[model samples]
Target: MRRGARYRWVVLAVATFTQAASGFFVQGIGAMGIQLQRELGLSTAQLGLLVSAAQFVPLVGLLVAGELLDRCDERWVVGAGAGVVAVALGAGALVPGYAGLLAVLLVVGAGYSTVQPGGSKSVASWFHASQRGFAMGVRQAGLPLGAAFASAVLPLVAGAFGWRAALVTGGFVALLGAVAFMTLYRRPPGRAVLPRARTPRGVRMRLLREPAMVRTMLAGAGLISVQCGVGILTVLYLHEVAHAGAGAAALVLVATQGTGVLGRIALAAWSDRVGVGRQRAVVVCMVAVVAGMAVLLTPAGRSAAVACCAFLWLGFFGFGWYGPWVAQVTESAPPDRTGFALGLAMSVNQIAIVAVPPLLGLLKDLSGGFAPAWGLLIAMTLAALVASVRTGGARRSADPAPDRDEVACPS
Candidate 1:
């Protein structure tokens, strides 16, 4: 039991680092907004498209990865996916034009799709319900932690050496993640000794109909949109509107990601203590994000001190919201099909991530300011929050979840 406990921590560490390493580049791209725009002569929309390109393939790829995870071990599936990201970014580093970079990122997205569900399921398997929320938060916090490091470092590399060098930096880190995962990750002790079985057909379809799933989808869509908006625009907004220097703006972006890291861990830890009512925590995040964006939409946010505080607030709630939300998903998921549930929830989120960055950028480009873009996200999040609240009540008034045997694995 002690060996297993220690090994579970090892699993958590590897899973967390892999999450960070795999996402380092894409998540940090927003901080590189100034460099990419200058070196490549990219418009706001074009810069946003870079993130979109990386996210595009994940839309369908996540669903496929979910199926793969239910059938195979996470070690191979996740490691191979991270390897693809490392190669795509590293090799594509020297591409001469923007179009080629986008093509390369599409491949990166394909590889990254496997990592999310794979890592989540791996942690879920090792940790039980009592500790899972906190464990998942620590694992999920890797995204922002990696992004924060990348935000600080990648921008400097892009500014000093060139954007291509930054690509190499991200890829090298991803390679480390791939190697670590393949070498270190193992299924829970007993499960590895048993024969593997496939998750039954229609698992994904049935998951879509669950009340918990509806909340997950709604919450994920809204918060993911906010997360992308924050990443792609924070540096640019600070530099352009607030008249901060390049380095100062980058630092602010780093701070935002830093807060995001704290939010993920703290909120998740909170959920672990709260038991089954995690959605209330998500609602609080939504309300907080809405408040921060409302500030940004007004003149009060024009002050540097105020703007910084608002972004930090947005970072905390907007990014932090996922910990509890994802915990809720795992909490509600059928034990055997946690991977499929995670994949299904995340795939729904991929739609917003792929679509939001470019659209928000376009909104900024068209309106010639950040207000319109902020307003749109404010609207999106508010809508989702309202829907979540209504659905929660209706769900309580409705019938209970069906038995697990109805969705059991193949015998």
Candidate 2:
């Protein structure tokens, strides 16, 4: 039992590392935007599409990944998917032109679609309800942690060896992560047995009709829009509007993602204290993100210090909110359905993720300022906050029992 207890933490560590490695390249795109723009002579909208391209396939791919996880071992599914990311990015290094890069990222996105849900399902299967929030938070933190690491280092890598070398570097990191997970990962005891039969589609579809599920899905859309906006535009806004240098702006983006890592763990730990009631924590994050965006709309956002603080605030609440939000999602699933629930809910979120960055970039281009873009995020977050509050009564009554089926490795 002592040895068994220790393995869960090992699972968490491996899941987190693989998740980070899988997303390393795409997460650094915003930091590389200016350089790519200079070299390729691309417009802001084009750069935004570059970010969106990686997210676009996930809309459908997540659902597929979720179904795959329910039937297969997460180890093979996740490791293979991440290996695809490494290969695609390595090939992308040799490909020239903006279109080729987009094509490469689309394949990368297809691969990454497995990592998030696969990692989440893997961690959720290992931890129980009482501590699941924190576990999920730590796992989710991998995305921002990877992004933050890449944001800081990739720019320097690109500066010295060119962008192609940076791509190759991401490929190498992902390859190492893939090999590690495949070698070390094992299914928890009892989960080694496969399901006797596949879950029916109708039963899975019923999740969409649940009031709590619908509310959580809506909230995720708004929150993800805010996340996408910040990830894609923070550096650009700092560089163009605040007159910060490229290095400084990218560093601020790094800070933004760094705070996100802290916020995910902090907020998730807070949710564990709050018990199974998780959406309230998400509401708090939504309100905080709205306030951060409001600050950015004011003249204070132009000051380098103020803008950095605002981005940190946004990063903390904006990106951090996923801990409780995802906890709520897993908790809300029907018996044996955590993977599908997470995938379905997050796949719905991919719509906003795919649309918001390019749309925000277009807004920036049209308004010639950041105000309108920030305002849109504020509006979306406010709507989410209100929806969450209105559905609080439902969430209170909607707590489902933990799923009995754990994700297992296939023999």
Q: For candidate 1, write residues 323-386 as lDDT tens digits.
A: 8888788766776666778888998898999889899999999999999999999999999998
lDDT of 2: 0.86
lDDT of 2 by residue, 1-411 (tens): 557667889999999999888889888988988887887888878888988899999999999888888878889999999999899999989898888989988998998888898889888877877678899899999989999999998888988888888889999888877887888877777765466355577867778878788889989999999999999899999998789999999999999999999999999889988744787688889989999999888888888889899999999999998888888888788646777888999999999988988889899888888889999999998987787778766734355553452222111
- The TM-score of predicted model 1 comes to 0.94
RMSD of each: 3.6, 2.5
Error of 2 at 46 (Å): 0.7
Please list the C-alpha lDDT of all candidates, in the order they appear. 0.86, 0.86
Instruction: Compute the lDDT of residue 293 as modeled in candidate 2.
Output: 90
What overall lDDT, based on C-alpha atoms, would model 1 receive against the true structure? 0.86
Can you give the lDDT of residue 45 in candidate 2?
81
